[model samples]
Target: MLALERVSKTYPNGVEALARFSAAIKQGEIVAIIGGSGCGKSTLLRAIAGLDRASSGTVTLDDEAISSPHAKIGIIFQEPRLLPWLSVADNIGFGLADLPAAERRGKVARALERVGLADKADAWPRELSGGQAQRVAIARALVPQPEVLLLDEPFSALDAFTRRDLQDHLLDLWADTRPTLILVTHDVDEAVVLADRVLVMRPRPGRLFDQIEINLARPRDRNSPLFDSFKRNVLTSLDRSLDRNVPDRDATQGPGQAMWW
Candidate 1:
Protein backbone atom coordinates (compact mmCIF):
# COMPACT_ATOMS: atom_id res chain seq x y z
CA MET A 1 0.00 0.00 0.00
CA LEU A 2 3.05 2.22 -0.33
CA ALA A 3 4.79 3.45 -3.48
CA LEU A 4 7.93 5.44 -4.24
CA GLU A 5 8.08 6.95 -7.71
CA ARG A 6 11.44 8.15 -8.95
CA VAL A 7 12.21 9.42 -5.46
CA SER A 8 15.54 11.23 -4.97
CA LYS A 9 16.99 13.15 -2.05
CA THR A 10 19.93 15.58 -2.25
CA TYR A 11 21.62 17.26 0.65
CA PRO A 12 22.31 21.01 0.85
CA ASN A 13 25.90 20.22 -0.04
CA GLY A 14 24.63 18.56 -3.27
CA VAL A 15 25.37 14.96 -2.34
CA GLU A 16 22.70 12.74 -3.84
CA ALA A 17 21.49 10.33 -1.18
CA LEU A 18 18.92 8.75 -3.48
CA ALA A 19 18.58 8.62 -7.24
CA ARG A 20 15.36 7.60 -8.91
CA PHE A 21 14.77 4.92 -6.30
CA SER A 22 11.37 3.30 -6.69
CA ALA A 23 9.49 0.45 -5.04
CA ALA A 24 5.91 -0.70 -4.52
CA ILE A 25 5.20 -2.48 -1.24
CA LYS A 26 2.02 -4.43 -0.65
CA GLN A 27 0.02 -4.28 2.55
CA GLY A 28 1.28 -6.52 5.37
CA GLU A 29 4.52 -7.33 3.56
CA ILE A 30 7.86 -7.30 5.40
CA VAL A 31 10.70 -5.82 3.31
CA ALA A 32 14.35 -5.40 4.24
CA ILE A 33 16.82 -2.99 2.67
CA ILE A 34 20.55 -3.90 2.78
CA GLY A 35 23.48 -1.98 1.36
CA GLY A 36 26.88 -0.39 1.97
CA SER A 37 27.49 2.31 4.60
CA GLY A 38 26.80 5.44 2.56
CA CYS A 39 23.79 4.11 0.65
CA GLY A 40 20.49 6.01 1.02
CA LYS A 41 18.65 3.18 2.80
CA SER A 42 17.88 5.36 5.84
CA THR A 43 17.21 8.39 3.66
CA LEU A 44 14.52 6.47 1.74
CA LEU A 45 12.80 5.54 4.99
CA ARG A 46 12.67 9.24 6.07
CA ALA A 47 11.13 10.18 2.75
CA ILE A 48 8.46 7.47 3.04
CA ALA A 49 7.69 8.38 6.64
CA GLY A 50 7.41 12.01 5.55
CA LEU A 51 9.96 12.98 8.19
CA ASP A 52 11.86 14.66 5.34
CA ARG A 53 11.02 15.85 1.85
CA ALA A 54 12.61 14.34 -1.24
CA SER A 55 14.49 16.49 -3.70
CA SER A 56 12.44 14.95 -6.52
CA GLY A 57 9.45 12.66 -7.17
CA THR A 58 6.98 11.41 -4.60
CA VAL A 59 6.26 8.94 -1.79
CA THR A 60 2.67 7.83 -1.56
CA LEU A 61 0.57 5.88 0.93
CA ASP A 62 -2.71 4.30 -0.17
CA ASP A 63 -2.36 6.15 -3.48
CA GLU A 64 -2.18 9.57 -1.79
CA ALA A 65 1.05 11.57 -1.85
CA ILE A 66 2.68 11.85 1.59
CA SER A 67 4.00 15.35 2.32
CA SER A 68 4.50 15.39 6.08
CA PRO A 69 4.24 13.25 9.16
CA HIS A 70 0.95 11.37 8.88
CA ALA A 71 -0.98 9.07 11.22
CA LYS A 72 -0.68 6.10 8.89
CA ILE A 73 3.09 5.96 9.41
CA GLY A 74 5.16 4.86 12.44
CA ILE A 75 8.95 4.80 12.84
CA ILE A 76 11.39 3.30 15.36
CA PHE A 77 14.85 4.79 15.36
CA GLN A 78 18.22 3.23 16.29
CA GLU A 79 18.00 4.76 19.75
CA PRO A 80 14.87 4.62 21.88
CA ARG A 81 14.00 8.32 21.95
CA LEU A 82 12.00 8.09 25.17
CA LEU A 83 11.51 11.13 27.33
CA PRO A 84 13.19 10.53 30.68
CA TRP A 85 10.55 12.65 32.40
CA LEU A 86 7.79 10.24 31.38
CA SER A 87 6.90 6.82 32.75
CA VAL A 88 6.53 3.79 30.48
CA ALA A 89 2.78 4.09 30.27
CA ASP A 90 2.88 7.83 29.76
CA ASN A 91 5.44 7.49 26.99
CA ILE A 92 3.21 5.01 25.17
CA GLY A 93 0.15 7.20 25.48
CA PHE A 94 2.01 10.32 24.38
CA GLY A 95 0.52 10.11 20.91
CA LEU A 96 -2.97 9.52 22.26
CA ALA A 97 -3.36 12.71 24.28
CA ASP A 98 -6.52 13.72 22.40
CA LEU A 99 -8.31 10.53 23.41
CA PRO A 100 -10.32 10.13 26.60
CA ALA A 101 -8.46 8.93 29.67
CA ALA A 102 -10.05 5.48 29.72
CA GLU A 103 -9.48 4.84 26.02
CA ARG A 104 -5.87 6.00 26.22
CA ARG A 105 -5.21 3.82 29.22
CA GLY A 106 -6.71 0.79 27.51
CA LYS A 107 -4.66 1.41 24.39
CA VAL A 108 -1.45 1.75 26.35
CA ALA A 109 -2.21 -1.38 28.34
CA ARG A 110 -2.74 -3.44 25.21
CA ALA A 111 0.41 -2.12 23.58
CA LEU A 112 2.50 -2.73 26.70
CA GLU A 113 1.12 -6.25 27.06
CA ARG A 114 1.76 -6.98 23.39
CA VAL A 115 5.39 -6.01 23.82
CA GLY A 116 5.56 -8.07 27.03
CA LEU A 117 6.16 -5.03 29.19
CA ALA A 118 2.85 -4.66 30.99
CA ASP A 119 4.70 -4.81 34.32
CA LYS A 120 6.84 -1.84 33.33
CA ALA A 121 3.84 0.46 32.88
CA ASP A 122 4.66 2.52 35.93
CA ALA A 123 8.44 2.38 35.61
CA TRP A 124 10.25 5.52 34.49
CA PRO A 125 12.27 5.51 31.28
CA ARG A 126 15.54 5.59 33.21
CA GLU A 127 14.63 2.42 35.09
CA LEU A 128 14.49 0.25 31.97
CA SER A 129 17.39 -1.56 30.35
CA GLY A 130 18.34 -1.05 26.69
CA GLY A 131 16.11 -3.87 25.39
CA GLN A 132 13.25 -2.85 27.68
CA ALA A 133 13.56 0.73 26.59
CA GLN A 134 13.43 -0.31 22.94
CA ARG A 135 10.33 -2.41 23.64
CA VAL A 136 8.68 0.65 25.11
CA ALA A 137 9.57 2.53 21.96
CA ILE A 138 7.94 -0.21 19.87
CA ALA A 139 4.87 -0.11 22.09
CA ARG A 140 4.60 3.62 21.63
CA ALA A 141 4.71 3.21 17.87
CA LEU A 142 2.11 0.42 17.83
CA VAL A 143 -0.28 2.22 20.18
CA PRO A 144 -1.46 4.28 17.23
CA GLN A 145 -2.15 1.09 15.19
CA PRO A 146 -0.27 2.48 12.23
CA GLU A 147 -0.87 1.16 8.70
CA VAL A 148 2.89 1.05 8.02
CA LEU A 149 5.86 0.47 10.36
CA LEU A 150 9.34 1.75 9.47
CA LEU A 151 12.30 0.48 11.49
CA ASP A 152 15.72 1.96 10.78
CA GLU A 153 18.27 -0.35 12.35
CA PRO A 154 16.15 -0.63 15.46
CA PHE A 155 18.00 -3.69 16.80
CA SER A 156 21.49 -2.85 15.58
CA ALA A 157 22.84 -1.59 18.89
CA LEU A 158 21.61 -4.43 21.07
CA ASP A 159 23.70 -7.52 21.88
CA ALA A 160 23.28 -10.67 19.79
CA PHE A 161 20.97 -12.41 22.25
CA THR A 162 18.84 -9.33 22.77
CA ARG A 163 18.70 -8.62 19.06
CA ARG A 164 17.50 -12.15 18.27
CA ASP A 165 14.85 -11.92 20.97
CA LEU A 166 13.58 -8.64 19.58
CA GLN A 167 13.56 -9.98 16.04
CA ASP A 168 11.18 -12.77 17.05
CA HIS A 169 9.14 -10.28 19.05
CA LEU A 170 8.89 -8.04 16.01
CA LEU A 171 7.71 -10.90 13.79
CA ASP A 172 5.02 -11.76 16.32
CA LEU A 173 3.86 -8.16 16.39
CA TRP A 174 3.81 -7.96 12.60
CA ALA A 175 1.82 -11.17 12.35
CA ASP A 176 -0.73 -9.80 14.79
CA THR A 177 -1.08 -6.27 13.37
CA ARG A 178 -0.28 -6.97 9.68
CA PRO A 179 1.21 -3.52 9.05
CA THR A 180 3.46 -3.00 6.04
CA LEU A 181 7.01 -3.34 7.42
CA ILE A 182 10.26 -1.87 6.06
CA LEU A 183 13.51 -2.68 7.86
CA VAL A 184 16.89 -1.12 7.01
CA THR A 185 19.73 -3.37 8.09
CA HIS A 186 23.39 -4.21 7.32
CA ASP A 187 23.38 -7.85 8.36
CA VAL A 188 22.67 -10.20 5.48
CA ASP A 189 21.55 -13.08 7.68
CA GLU A 190 19.16 -10.82 9.53
CA ALA A 191 17.73 -9.58 6.25
CA VAL A 192 17.28 -13.10 4.86
CA VAL A 193 15.46 -14.33 7.90
CA LEU A 194 13.23 -11.30 8.43
CA ALA A 195 12.18 -10.10 5.01
CA ASP A 196 9.68 -11.35 2.45
CA ARG A 197 11.83 -9.43 -0.01
CA VAL A 198 15.30 -7.94 0.31
CA LEU A 199 16.20 -4.88 -1.74
CA VAL A 200 19.94 -4.45 -2.21
CA MET A 201 21.09 -0.91 -2.96
CA ARG A 202 24.18 0.71 -4.51
CA PRO A 203 25.78 3.94 -3.28
CA ARG A 204 27.13 7.07 -4.98
CA PRO A 205 23.63 8.25 -5.77
CA GLY A 206 22.12 5.27 -3.88
CA ARG A 207 19.71 3.30 -6.00
CA LEU A 208 18.14 -0.15 -5.99
CA PHE A 209 20.48 -2.79 -7.39
CA ASP A 210 18.46 -5.96 -6.90
CA GLN A 211 15.17 -7.04 -5.40
CA ILE A 212 15.77 -10.53 -3.94
CA GLU A 213 12.66 -12.33 -2.78
CA ILE A 214 12.95 -14.82 0.08
CA ASN A 215 10.49 -17.57 -0.69
CA LEU A 216 11.55 -19.59 2.33
CA ALA A 217 8.96 -20.67 4.87
CA ARG A 218 8.44 -18.88 8.16
CA PRO A 219 10.88 -19.55 11.04
CA ARG A 220 13.61 -19.69 8.46
CA ASP A 221 16.52 -22.07 8.85
CA ARG A 222 19.67 -20.01 9.20
CA ASN A 223 21.90 -23.05 8.68
CA SER A 224 20.04 -24.34 5.62
CA PRO A 225 21.85 -24.46 2.30
CA LEU A 226 19.19 -22.24 0.66
CA PHE A 227 19.58 -19.64 3.35
CA ASP A 228 23.33 -19.59 2.85
CA SER A 229 22.80 -19.30 -0.91
CA PHE A 230 20.58 -16.26 -0.48
CA LYS A 231 23.14 -14.66 1.85
CA ARG A 232 25.90 -15.31 -0.67
CA ASN A 233 23.91 -13.71 -3.50
CA VAL A 234 23.26 -10.59 -1.42
CA LEU A 235 26.94 -10.35 -0.51
CA THR A 236 27.92 -10.78 -4.15
CA SER A 237 25.63 -7.90 -5.12
CA LEU A 238 27.14 -5.77 -2.36
CA ASP A 239 30.61 -6.53 -3.62
CA ARG A 240 29.56 -5.42 -7.09
CA SER A 241 28.19 -2.20 -5.64
CA LEU A 242 31.52 -1.47 -3.92
CA ASP A 243 33.01 -0.79 -7.35
CA ARG A 244 31.02 2.44 -7.34
CA ASN A 245 34.16 3.98 -5.90
CA VAL A 246 37.44 2.11 -5.31
CA PRO A 247 37.82 -0.25 -8.25
CA ASP A 248 37.96 -3.93 -7.31
CA ARG A 249 41.45 -5.13 -6.45
CA ASP A 250 42.87 -8.61 -5.91
CA ALA A 251 44.43 -7.49 -2.60
CA THR A 252 43.13 -5.66 0.48
CA GLN A 253 43.14 -1.87 0.36
CA GLY A 254 44.43 0.63 2.96
CA PRO A 255 42.28 1.91 5.81
CA GLY A 256 39.05 3.71 4.87
CA GLN A 257 39.01 2.03 1.45
CA ALA A 258 36.42 -0.59 0.49
CA MET A 259 37.74 -4.13 1.00
CA TRP A 260 37.77 -6.30 -2.12
CA TRP A 261 35.76 -9.51 -1.85
Candidate 2:
Protein backbone atom coordinates (compact mmCIF):
# COMPACT_ATOMS: atom_id res chain seq x y z
CA MET A 1 0.00 0.00 0.00
CA LEU A 2 1.07 3.58 -0.64
CA ALA A 3 0.09 6.24 1.86
CA LEU A 4 0.51 9.98 2.12
CA GLU A 5 -0.13 11.31 5.58
CA ARG A 6 -0.64 15.02 6.09
CA VAL A 7 1.95 15.71 3.40
CA SER A 8 2.88 19.27 2.56
CA LYS A 9 5.46 21.08 0.42
CA THR A 10 6.74 24.62 0.71
CA TYR A 11 9.37 26.27 -1.40
CA PRO A 12 12.20 28.51 -0.25
CA ASN A 13 10.24 31.50 -1.60
CA GLY A 14 7.54 30.74 0.94
CA VAL A 15 5.16 29.42 -1.67
CA GLU A 16 3.15 26.59 -0.20
CA ALA A 17 2.52 24.32 -3.14
CA LEU A 18 0.82 21.50 -1.30
CA ALA A 19 -1.20 21.59 1.88
CA ARG A 20 -1.86 18.89 4.42
CA PHE A 21 -2.72 16.35 1.78
CA SER A 22 -3.34 12.74 2.69
CA ALA A 23 -4.44 9.74 0.70
CA ALA A 24 -4.10 5.98 0.83
CA ILE A 25 -3.65 4.07 -2.44
CA LYS A 26 -4.15 0.34 -2.63
CA GLN A 27 -1.56 -1.97 -4.14
CA GLY A 28 -1.98 -2.31 -7.92
CA GLU A 29 -4.71 0.34 -8.01
CA ILE A 30 -4.68 3.17 -10.54
CA VAL A 31 -5.23 6.65 -9.07
CA ALA A 32 -5.56 9.91 -10.96
CA ILE A 33 -4.87 13.32 -9.46
CA ILE A 34 -6.45 16.29 -11.26
CA GLY A 35 -6.51 20.02 -10.68
CA GLY A 36 -5.90 23.34 -12.40
CA SER A 37 -2.45 24.79 -13.08
CA GLY A 38 -0.10 25.18 -10.12
CA CYS A 39 -2.15 22.78 -8.04
CA GLY A 40 1.09 20.97 -6.96
CA LYS A 41 0.37 17.89 -8.98
CA SER A 42 3.96 17.96 -10.17
CA THR A 43 5.27 18.56 -6.71
CA LEU A 44 3.22 15.75 -5.22
CA LEU A 45 4.34 13.31 -7.90
CA ARG A 46 7.98 14.27 -7.40
CA ALA A 47 7.73 13.94 -3.65
CA ILE A 48 6.15 10.55 -3.95
CA ALA A 49 8.95 9.54 -6.30
CA GLY A 50 11.48 10.83 -3.75
CA LEU A 51 12.79 13.37 -6.29
CA ASP A 52 11.69 16.10 -3.88
CA ARG A 53 11.36 16.20 -0.14
CA ALA A 54 8.14 17.04 1.60
CA SER A 55 8.47 19.83 4.11
CA SER A 56 6.18 18.04 6.51
CA GLY A 57 4.34 14.75 6.98
CA THR A 58 5.44 11.53 5.36
CA VAL A 59 4.95 9.38 2.26
CA THR A 60 5.34 5.66 2.53
CA LEU A 61 5.11 2.55 0.38
CA ASP A 62 4.60 -0.73 2.14
CA ASP A 63 5.29 1.04 5.45
CA GLU A 64 8.73 2.32 4.41
CA ALA A 65 9.26 6.08 4.27
CA ILE A 66 10.26 7.28 0.81
CA SER A 67 13.17 9.56 1.53
CA SER A 68 15.16 8.95 -1.63
CA PRO A 69 14.66 7.51 -5.05
CA HIS A 70 13.45 3.93 -4.82
CA ALA A 71 14.32 1.38 -7.48
CA LYS A 72 10.81 -0.04 -7.32
CA ILE A 73 9.29 3.33 -8.26
CA GLY A 74 9.48 4.55 -11.87
CA ILE A 75 8.36 7.94 -13.20
CA ILE A 76 7.25 8.98 -16.67
CA PHE A 77 7.39 12.68 -17.41
CA GLN A 78 5.60 14.94 -19.90
CA GLU A 79 8.38 14.51 -22.46
CA PRO A 80 10.01 11.38 -23.75
CA ARG A 81 13.48 12.59 -22.67
CA LEU A 82 15.14 9.96 -24.81
CA LEU A 83 18.77 10.19 -25.80
CA PRO A 84 19.09 11.20 -29.42
CA TRP A 85 22.05 8.88 -30.01
CA LEU A 86 20.57 5.75 -28.48
CA SER A 87 18.44 3.08 -30.09
CA VAL A 88 14.98 2.41 -28.67
CA ALA A 89 16.14 -0.84 -27.08
CA ASP A 90 19.22 0.75 -25.56
CA ASN A 91 17.22 3.59 -24.06
CA ILE A 92 14.85 1.15 -22.41
CA GLY A 93 17.80 -0.74 -20.99
CA PHE A 94 19.59 2.37 -19.74
CA GLY A 95 18.76 1.67 -16.11
CA LEU A 96 19.71 -1.97 -16.29
CA ALA A 97 23.45 -1.50 -16.45
CA ASP A 98 23.95 -3.45 -13.22
CA LEU A 99 22.42 -6.54 -14.77
CA PRO A 100 24.30 -8.95 -17.04
CA ALA A 101 24.28 -8.00 -20.72
CA ALA A 102 22.12 -11.01 -21.57
CA GLU A 103 19.64 -10.22 -18.78
CA ARG A 104 19.41 -6.54 -19.78
CA ARG A 105 18.87 -7.51 -23.41
CA GLY A 106 16.08 -9.85 -22.40
CA LYS A 107 14.34 -7.18 -20.33
CA VAL A 108 14.63 -4.56 -23.06
CA ALA A 109 13.30 -7.00 -25.66
CA ARG A 110 10.29 -7.81 -23.53
CA ALA A 111 9.55 -4.13 -22.87
CA LEU A 112 9.82 -3.28 -26.55
CA GLU A 113 7.41 -6.10 -27.35
CA ARG A 114 5.05 -4.94 -24.62
CA VAL A 115 4.89 -1.45 -26.11
CA GLY A 116 4.50 -2.86 -29.62
CA LEU A 117 7.83 -1.48 -30.70
CA ALA A 118 9.80 -4.66 -31.21
CA ASP A 119 10.31 -3.76 -34.84
CA LYS A 120 11.69 -0.35 -33.89
CA ALA A 121 14.11 -1.66 -31.31
CA ASP A 122 17.11 -0.58 -33.39
CA ALA A 123 15.58 2.72 -34.55
CA TRP A 124 16.84 6.05 -33.25
CA PRO A 125 14.55 8.40 -31.30
CA ARG A 126 14.41 10.90 -34.20
CA GLU A 127 13.10 8.20 -36.51
CA LEU A 128 9.96 7.57 -34.44
CA SER A 129 6.73 9.56 -34.60
CA GLY A 130 5.36 11.39 -31.62
CA GLY A 131 3.25 8.45 -30.46
CA GLN A 132 6.03 6.01 -31.13
CA ALA A 133 8.43 8.12 -29.11
CA GLN A 134 6.03 8.15 -26.21
CA ARG A 135 5.69 4.40 -26.53
CA VAL A 136 9.44 4.16 -26.22
CA ALA A 137 9.25 6.33 -23.13
CA ILE A 138 6.63 4.04 -21.68
CA ALA A 139 8.78 1.04 -22.49
CA ARG A 140 11.72 2.64 -20.72
CA ALA A 141 9.59 3.31 -17.67
CA LEU A 142 8.14 -0.18 -17.72
CA VAL A 143 11.39 -2.02 -18.42
CA PRO A 144 12.02 -2.13 -14.72
CA GLN A 145 8.51 -3.44 -14.16
CA PRO A 146 8.12 -0.96 -11.33
CA GLU A 147 5.76 -1.85 -8.54
CA VAL A 148 4.75 1.82 -8.41
CA LEU A 149 4.51 3.98 -11.54
CA LEU A 150 4.02 7.73 -11.56
CA LEU A 151 3.00 9.47 -14.77
CA ASP A 152 2.92 13.25 -15.14
CA GLU A 153 0.75 14.12 -18.12
CA PRO A 154 2.75 11.71 -20.25
CA PHE A 155 0.25 11.78 -23.16
CA SER A 156 -0.94 15.39 -23.00
CA ALA A 157 1.05 16.40 -26.04
CA LEU A 158 -0.29 13.78 -28.43
CA ASP A 159 -3.17 14.19 -30.86
CA ALA A 160 -6.63 12.95 -29.85
CA PHE A 161 -6.39 9.73 -31.83
CA THR A 162 -2.87 8.94 -30.66
CA ARG A 163 -3.76 9.81 -27.10
CA ARG A 164 -6.73 7.47 -27.19
CA ASP A 165 -4.57 4.72 -28.63
CA LEU A 166 -1.99 5.14 -25.89
CA GLN A 167 -4.69 5.13 -23.26
CA ASP A 168 -5.96 1.83 -24.59
CA HIS A 169 -2.43 0.49 -24.53
CA LEU A 170 -2.01 1.58 -20.93
CA LEU A 171 -5.17 -0.23 -19.88
CA ASP A 172 -4.04 -3.36 -21.67
CA LEU A 173 -0.72 -3.32 -19.86
CA TRP A 174 -2.42 -2.70 -16.53
CA ALA A 175 -4.74 -5.61 -17.08
CA ASP A 176 -1.83 -7.88 -17.89
CA THR A 177 0.23 -6.84 -14.89
CA ARG A 178 -1.35 -4.46 -12.43
CA PRO A 179 0.96 -1.90 -10.87
CA THR A 180 0.21 0.84 -8.38
CA LEU A 181 -0.07 3.77 -10.80
CA ILE A 182 -0.64 7.46 -10.22
CA LEU A 183 -1.47 9.54 -13.28
CA VAL A 184 -1.48 13.31 -12.83
CA THR A 185 -3.57 14.86 -15.54
CA HIS A 186 -5.72 17.93 -16.09
CA ASP A 187 -8.16 16.17 -18.44
CA VAL A 188 -11.24 15.13 -16.49
CA ASP A 189 -12.34 12.54 -19.02
CA GLU A 190 -8.90 10.96 -19.03
CA ALA A 191 -9.02 10.59 -15.27
CA VAL A 192 -12.52 9.12 -15.35
CA VAL A 193 -11.60 6.62 -18.01
CA LEU A 194 -8.23 5.53 -16.59
CA ALA A 195 -8.28 5.72 -12.82
CA ASP A 196 -9.76 3.40 -10.26
CA ARG A 197 -10.13 6.55 -8.15
CA VAL A 198 -10.09 10.25 -8.96
CA LEU A 199 -8.67 12.82 -6.58
CA VAL A 200 -10.02 16.31 -7.20
CA MET A 201 -7.69 18.95 -5.80
CA ARG A 202 -8.13 22.61 -4.93
CA PRO A 203 -5.40 25.08 -5.84
CA ARG A 204 -3.73 27.96 -3.95
CA PRO A 205 -2.31 25.69 -1.29
CA GLY A 206 -3.00 22.58 -3.27
CA ARG A 207 -5.05 20.11 -1.30
CA LEU A 208 -7.41 17.26 -1.86
CA PHE A 209 -11.02 18.39 -2.15
CA ASP A 210 -12.91 15.28 -3.15
CA GLN A 211 -12.44 11.62 -3.93
CA ILE A 212 -14.46 9.84 -6.61
CA GLU A 213 -14.35 6.08 -6.83
CA ILE A 214 -14.84 4.59 -10.28
CA ASN A 215 -17.14 1.60 -9.95
CA LEU A 216 -17.36 0.96 -13.68
CA ALA A 217 -15.88 -2.16 -15.22
CA ARG A 218 -12.81 -2.34 -17.49
CA PRO A 219 -12.86 -1.50 -21.23
CA ARG A 220 -14.94 1.49 -20.16
CA ASP A 221 -17.05 2.95 -22.92
CA ARG A 222 -16.85 6.72 -23.02
CA ASN A 223 -20.15 6.71 -24.95
CA SER A 224 -21.93 5.00 -22.07
CA PRO A 225 -24.24 6.98 -19.86
CA LEU A 226 -22.43 5.60 -16.83
CA PHE A 227 -19.14 7.05 -18.06
CA ASP A 228 -20.79 10.38 -18.82
CA SER A 229 -22.25 10.49 -15.32
CA PHE A 230 -18.84 9.93 -13.76
CA LYS A 231 -17.30 12.59 -15.98
CA ARG A 232 -20.06 15.02 -14.99
CA ASN A 233 -19.44 14.34 -11.32
CA VAL A 234 -15.73 15.06 -11.75
CA LEU A 235 -16.45 18.29 -13.60
CA THR A 236 -18.95 19.39 -10.97
CA SER A 237 -16.45 18.67 -8.22
CA LEU A 238 -13.75 20.62 -10.07
CA ASP A 239 -16.13 23.55 -10.61
CA ARG A 240 -17.03 23.57 -6.94
CA SER A 241 -13.36 23.57 -6.00
CA LEU A 242 -12.76 26.41 -8.47
CA ASP A 243 -15.60 28.30 -6.91
CA ARG A 244 -13.77 28.17 -3.61
CA ASN A 245 -10.35 28.99 -5.11
CA VAL A 246 -11.34 31.63 -7.63
CA PRO A 247 -12.48 35.00 -6.36
CA ASP A 248 -15.28 37.15 -7.74
CA ARG A 249 -15.36 36.63 -11.51
CA ASP A 250 -15.58 40.32 -12.27
CA ALA A 251 -12.47 41.15 -10.28
CA THR A 252 -10.38 38.27 -11.54
CA GLN A 253 -11.33 38.58 -15.19
CA GLY A 254 -9.69 41.21 -17.36
CA PRO A 255 -12.00 43.95 -18.58
CA GLY A 256 -13.81 42.95 -21.81
CA GLN A 257 -12.31 39.44 -21.52
CA ALA A 258 -14.36 36.34 -20.83
CA MET A 259 -13.54 32.72 -20.23
CA TRP A 260 -15.61 29.60 -20.84
CA TRP A 261 -14.85 26.03 -19.89
On TM-score, the candidate that comes out on top is 2
List RMSD in Å for every model shown: 3.8, 4.4
Measured by TM-score, how close is model 1 to the native structure? 0.92
Error of 2 at 42 (Å): 0.8
Give one digit per residue, the lDDT tens place, for model 1 in 41-87.
99999999998999999999998999899999999999999989999
In model 2, residue pairs whose N, Cα or C atoms come closer than 3 Å (at least 3 residues apart or on different chains), thus clashing, are none
Global lDDT for candidate 2? Answer: 0.87
Candidate 2: segments with Cα more than 4 A from true spot: 244-261
Error of 2 at 67 (Å): 1.5
Give the Å shift of residue 16 in candidate 1.
1.0
lDDT of 1 at 178: 91
Regions of candidate 1 where Cα sits further than 4 Å from its true position: 244-261
Our tally of clashes for model 1 stands at 0
User: What is the Cα-based lDDT of residue 156 in candidate 1?
Assistant: 88
> Mind giving the per-residue lDDT tens digits that candidate 2 earns over 1-261?
999999999999999999999999999999999987788899999999999999999999999999899988999888999999999899999988899999999989988888989999999999999999999988888877788999999889898789889999988887766889999997777898899999988898999999999999989998898887787677667767777444443343332221112
Whole-model lDDT values for every prediction? 0.87, 0.87
